[model samples]
Target chain A: MYGMISTWRMAYEGVVNQFERLKEGEFAGNVLEASIREIEDFENFISVGYGGLPNEEGKLQLDAAYMNGSTFEIGAVAGMEDIKNPISVARLLSQDRFNIFRVGDGAKKFAESEGFLSENLLTDYSKNKWEERLKKVENEELTPYDGHDTVGTVVLDKDKNIVSGTSSSGLFMKKKGRIGDSPLPGSGFYADSDIGGATATGLGEDLMKGILSYEVVRRMGMGLSPMDAAQTSLKDFEEKLERKYGKVGAMSLVCMNNKGEWGIATNVDFTFVVATNEQEPTIYTSKRTEDGETVIEKAAAEWVEEYLSNVLTRQE
Target chain B: MYGMISTWRMAYEGVVNQFERLKEGEFAGNVLEASIREIEDFENFISVGYGGLPNEEGKLQLDAAYMNGSTFEIGAVAGMEDIKNPISVARLLSQDRFNIFRVGDGAKKFAESEGFLSENLLTDYSKNKWEERLKKVENEELTPYDGHDTVGTVVLDKDKNIVSGTSSSGLFMKKKGRIGDSPLPGSGFYADSDIGGATATGLGEDLMKGILSYEVVRRMGMGLSPMDAAQTSLKDFEEKLERKYGKVGAMSLVCMNNKGEWGIATNVDFTFVVATNEQEPTIYTSKRTEDGETVIEKAAAEWVEEYLSNVLTRQE
Candidate 1:
């Protein structure tokens, strides 16, 4: 999805609407949880949200991370299984430090203490344990793990402050022990309300090694347009991984100058949608491939108009 | 395969070798045709010189382009189906006008005038057309048309001269009336002995639209390594396609200075080997997936070495 930022008036309006039906404190929790849950539920083949391909081992092991650039607050988890919604946990952890939750057995214990069902399993593996198991199973028939591509958002408020969140299982069908860019601090998720906010999706290991976030931030600082900078970074990644070809794919969306502009670029052909208060959700893909010839400009115009309309309607 | 230069010595040696086996001036036509036939039989993946893939309509269409940078000579053809060996025809065309061989029905007449087999069908589509009524009645479906991917070669000889050639049937299962990058001057194959050379692989339409070959050449002029420039140009193709997370596999081999130093990059994890008189055939791929973790160094080393050894041994 394209970068999203609701103006102060837009967010305040949502808050006002929520206050009419619920208590003030409940609104923040509801909206955040709702947004995060949506991340968990995203199931499109193109988008990098939840329920995507498994790890190389073929099992669903979820991981996620998020950061509120405004407060310089962050949250993340590496190996969470039996958790239906990981983005929720990440959001909780990024909340007030007093309310920040720890993961692992303690996290499960806390969830149970709060009456959320927590499964009991003796064989759950931490990142370290998973690494050891990977060595042992190097020559064996290893099961694939879940590493769904990530879906994330960075919202710029009217004051131009920003909050960004990321959610993913990781690469689909990854190895049992593999950890992708998702849980890494700056690699998987980072945002700054002052200038702009960005989110990335693709091969996590490469992204982590490249320190991609810093590069994106650096480019943004140099005053390149969001689209040009994002596309340029993606091109760099392509050059680095040329010999591996299709083994990697990535997409990122960025909002700059308080949502005066935004950008989305990806390696493969797929759809990305953007929604804002002033526009209708607009969907964009390179060009729809039905029989083969690319319909280039037709698809672009449809997306731009639809997106603008969606944003306009949301203003009410 | 990365860029290669069959030295002027190698070409002369091959021609002389063929000449030695023939009686002086007795069958000069047969000798030259047989020599060209050698390259026609080199490889078979539907993308190589002869018998390439057909278009979606099951019609056989072929495109070929060749340039000898040393001589500043070039030849190209498109939508010709009856030519038995297009490369040979192209080579003849590039030589003195007296060497030009008539093709299609005219070629058959010329062959008969020269007492060679004049009735052999050059394309399956041509054979099918003769039996059109019977073909429609036949319940069995014929193999569907799959247009060829562009196959190209660039050679720098001992004289520091360059030669490049490309041939393709077009895209696999493509729409009718589609032409590929093979016949394009810069998109498919290009070489300049003073600078460098490159050949492209993947969907020709995407490459042409992106002006990939020109981009690579321009980047090389800016001091980027030949391999890096090729990869950067390919990345431009990917972004143009909006492939956020899919493979658009391609490979390009490039050489810089005449020190024979070269670089190769591909989107797939396949070994590309090359042989040199100074070094054994070397094989290389940038990354390999092993037990879930991708190993970059080992993949590159082994592939380069193996391929180089093979190519060198074959040359010997």
Candidate 2:
């Protein structure tokens, strides 16, 4: 069976667009890359790729990673700028045995040398948002960080291969050269073709503390259902963080076992997209119950429409 | 109990120098930082800090990480240049709640903002070595990558607070902005106050594929002896990598439990420094047996003398 699961409502269209190729027995890596590229190229997705928000220095530095479960080959880039498709670059780097992880100017140089387009990625919409946020921080004592919706996807192919990828501009108005979990292995993403794969989107600083993605995948490997793996890992880690660090930030994870079964867990109202051989491409929203379980439901028509309108009508 | 274990014989002096403070019941974080800082300051140690080798562009980019086991606070820097003590910078970053991991220019800026000294770290010895290596690569087509002896240390204080830190110059002649496992949590180092902590040194690319540091700590938490945890994790990962990735790189790990028990494992003849309440600070060499267990013995006086002479007598 073939299936794909990704974080956020922004991934719904990409999953829908890529389902045909996945059903046609394409490799998991190619399908995952193509799906993420669609989101990266869309200017409306302010948290990833082309029009993603800038750092405190007004530079669009992106972080992305790709992991091939079958080979344990991982590639990643962080603090990269002017790279049109960070996900594609990460996938290309995964083919190399060394220097697979690059950062800052080195990442930019490698991407450009390898023929990935280097262009100005900052759109006016994002720039205006940065400016407005900067003013509020100066005048209102507000925090300058928000909007870290990373596009993380995990795919299982007909050949039983699993691959996971993640792309993010990181926390909006973050310090220069700041990176999140998007580019980290085990924390941001983990996959093992024989068992399953998992990807995360949330406060990267807190996420890396538990290596939650790897935990989810490991639990699945140990006979836990995908849903149980995702929920228990997230809940346990969050509680541990609260007791230790005195606070916890938002966190959401998505996982899929080799059987095309998928699961999700989140502390906030999080939307995700999933499609499988037994299920149509669909968007779902998830929230944590009081008992620390996750409640997942299909996105209502009204909610989907409202989300789309918000993206389409967003302005400075 | 108080204890410290560090990769490489290069750390012996630091461990020796810091044992007094550790015995006095200093906090684990302070002792770990001070011990690593001593290594970072020693220009004779070519693999880390002041005399560390340069990247392909003749730039000295360094990587380091700091983790507090009790709070699960992690801070790291990769591809950072001109910072005298990256371990100190990492420790300082761990105190923050966000943007704890910085790379490249951002790391430098953070270091400078925090009053970390900014100065040329490339010594004449390191520069001449880089030039000589460049000639050998051009003349003989030899791989320019070597000398990745990261100084990774794990310390447990009297209060059962565990802290782990790592510092490295990365692979000699690596690509600009290339980073290994040194700065990434879970892969390079992992610590838990109640259980144990582990740190790695070797081919970071291969090491990261296994997330071996975290695996060692997890095994210890599961009630394995420190030796069993370190040996089994390294052996299992090396075999798995050989099967999947076709080859394994030289890798070594050092770990310490809260009870001051320490263990070590390596595919090569690896030397490490350890001091604990039960054992005096001493250097030991370890190698893997045919059966995949580790054989560790106190380093001989002749071997220690030769190692020091080799460092002191090297000339251009």
Error of 2 at A228 (Å): 0.7
For model 2, how does the per-residue alpha-carbon lDDT over B61-85 read when each residue is reduced to its tens digit?
9999999999999999999999989
- Count clashes in each candidate, considering only residues at least 3 apart in sequence or on different chains: 71, 0
Tens-place lDDT per residue, model 1, A1-316, is 1125221111222323332222222322344335555545533321123334443343445566566655545555444555656666666655532223122333333344545554422122323334544665575655333223466555554444555556565654453323455544445555655456666665564454233553454467568777666667666755544432233434443334345466555554444444444544344454324653333222367655664455444320
Off by over 4 Å in 1: A1-33, A39-58, A96-116, A119-147, A241-257, A287-316, B1-316
Model 1 TM-score (2 dp): 0.37
TM-score of 2: 0.98
What TM-score does each of the candidates earn? 0.37, 0.98
Q: Candidate 2, which segments miss by more than 4 Å at Cα?
A: none
* Interface RMSD, every prediction, one decimal place: 27.3, 0.8
| Model 2: per-residue Cα lDDT over A85-176, one tens digit each | 99999998899878999999999999999988889999999999899899998897788876799999999999999999999999998888
